[model samples]
Target: MRSAFLIAPLLMMLSACAGEPTRMGASTKLVEAEEAILMPPPGSFSVAGITQKRFSNGLQQEIFLSTTSAVPGQNVVQMRLYGTRNDLRYRDDHLRFRTVTEAGIDAEMRGTLPGIPMKRSPYLVQNDYGAFGYAFGRPSPTELCMYAWQQLRTPEGEKPPFAGFGAVQIRVRICETGASERKLLAFMYGYSIIGAVDDMRWNPYGPPGPVSDRLGHSGNPIYPPEMTAGAEPDAARPVAVARPARRAVQPVAEPVPTALPGAERVVVPSPVRASSAAQPAANVAPASSAGGTIVPSPACVGANAATAAACP
Candidate 1:
């Protein structure tokens, strides 16, 4: 009985390390735990929109876009529910540097989570954090991870596969204006821990788990300040450019020719021939060949016509 009692506490400790804390909906418990240490986001910002995506493995990804009075663009924060396959190959730190450098992040900060191992990618550079490319153990109710990445000083147009890590990640970019490195880091820390906790609480596996009645509410939806103005917001949206129309073709006319100057005029008459009636009239009587004697015609009108001078 004593052995079983000791085993129970040991099992619970391991489970808590592997699972979400007792207060599922919030990361406060995690922060309270030594594993996480960060201040929560103050009333300065609120969630503007939530984009939720369900993957092929029945896992969910949620992106929370928040608007702050101190930031220019809406902060893009994401969280991937559950985790990835265990057998996937994790790239070396040298490869990780090469990858994110190619994607535009020039500098990186490396560290580990309290309970996770040192051999894995638990590091969060400038603005990147979350399940950093490795999966935690499965079936433990609260085991969730997230990541964030941003290329602040670098110019746009870096070939993707951004030099960061994670199998499933949530990225919250650092705002351009009205944002300091501290706030950006705070946001990264807040979301990587709390944002992931929020996602897991909202869409948990199997039976509905315990939720914080207080933190579960994601406040009222809001839009960016630029959109709240009374003008059309098409400038933010993409538009298609129309192509030009083609012109119709007109046909050419042929020219008429006149006779050339100084050319000789030639007249060619058509040949004429006597008809059958005229032939019979001219040869009314047949004449003897080389002799003055008259010859009779087979179709003679009168027998006297056949004789020479006496018949005519």
Candidate 2:
């Protein structure tokens, strides 16, 4: 009977062990697309999916997938935003992958990210949000990839609102086929943080700084070079003035003399001026030939003659 009881307990223990669920140490939940904090413009990138995870230690992670595919397989463009009440230590240890940490450490030590069996270079990017350091690589002959990470927290000496801790860690991995670096970086520039924790102290972005004194003051009108002077605020864009087309000038043809039938053609040469020391020739008037053609005098052949002057 004792052996039977022991076997029953052993079987019960084995059944319990087999039925126990695996502990993931974290709770994962599917979140709505609208709940995402980092929102890429709908025109350029639409949210295809989103996953939200809450760690036991109070770290929140939200990952967004865009409609554009990063690689040939099922992978898509991914943007991960992590919010922690304290510092980024938790993320570095638990949230980030081992390879990503190694890449980051290599970047810190070597001034560049270590490529995963490929060549990669550091890419610098800045926008209205903040400046970010990224690593760029070409995964294939036609595809390009860029990875960037940024952490936002209150300044070291500055006190956060309500004496509360606030920090945000952002990670982006984007790839495109036959896309330029500028096109890939445009996502970094256009993404906006639309959601935040309800607490006032959980502000990833601090108070707005004061605007420049020169802005919106007298003699500080802001206008582009293409803007016309004295344009009204509600006026339509100025029309471009059309230039007149140039007229091409045509050449005039010289008149040619025609010879009478059965009459020989005569050739004429321009006369050259005689030396002043030579005696002047006697005047000889031009005579009309039998065919009523006026013939030039011999004296006039070698003398300077005006076009309208009578031959002499």
Best-matching candidate per lDDT: 2
Candidate 2 lDDT, tens digit per residue, 1-312? 889988998998888866435456335667787777678755666776776665422445445455354454322333333344433223334444222464664454233223433344445657776666666667567777666666665565665547435566676666667878878777777788766666655655566679989896898777776677687567598999999999999999898977677975453422432222143344432343445444454556565544224342
lDDT of each: 0.35, 0.57
- Report how far residue 47 has shifted in candidate 2, in Å: 1.8
RMSD of candidates 1 onward, in order: 22.3, 16.0
In candidate 1, stretches whose alpha carbon ends up further than 4 angstroms from where it belongs are 1-44, 58-62, 68-73, 82-101, 104-168, 192-312
lDDT, residue 174, candidate 2: 64
Assess every candidate by TM-score.
0.25, 0.51
Worst 10 residues of 1 by lDDT: 28-37
Q: Please state the error at residue 197 of candidate 2 in Å.
A: 1.3
Among the numbered candidates, top TM-score falls to: 2
